[model samples]
Target: MSKLSKLSLITLFFWIVKIVATTLGETAGDLLSMTLNVGCAVSSTILIGVFLANLVTRLLSKSCN
Candidate 1:
């Protein structure tokens, strides 16, 4: 598993991506809701769509051995 228990480099890469994605997502959500004056519901829906797209790609990828 590339030197870590059931944790390959590819898996680690995805993990980093997921973390960064969520971090940016949080920022974007806040900006949309507060700065841009978008309502919470609309911001939430937009974030949900973004999360779902990431979820799809994550699900399609192979898991670590």
Candidate 2:
């Protein structure tokens, strides 16, 4: 008996999007805290709040399938 791979096009797309989003998020965070002089503590708090809000919204949303 042999096992087969389960990777699909959708899964690959999801990973690509995740990587891009993560890179963009880091860049934006640095810009906010350093370039804009927003201060690290405040910027971190704002970013964390946004992340939590998005996470909650996604969790509460219905599945597309």
C-alpha local distance difference test of each model: 0.87, 0.86
lDDT of 2 by residue, 1-65 (tens): 22323456667789999999999889979988999999889888989999999898889889843
Indicate the residue-level lDDT of 59 in model 2: 90
TM-score of 1: 0.55
Give the per-residue lDDT digits (tens) of candidate 1, residues 1-65: 44675567779899999999889988998999999999899999988998899889888889843
Cα shift from native, residue 41, model 1 (Å): 0.4
Candidate 1 overall Cα lDDT vs. reference? 0.87
Query: Quick one: best TM-score, which candidate?
Result: 2
Candidate 2 differs from the real structure by a C-alpha RMSD in angstroms, to one decimal, of 3.7
lDDT of 2 at 65: 32
Superposed on all Cα atoms, the candidates' RMSDs to the truth, in angstroms, are 5.5, 3.7
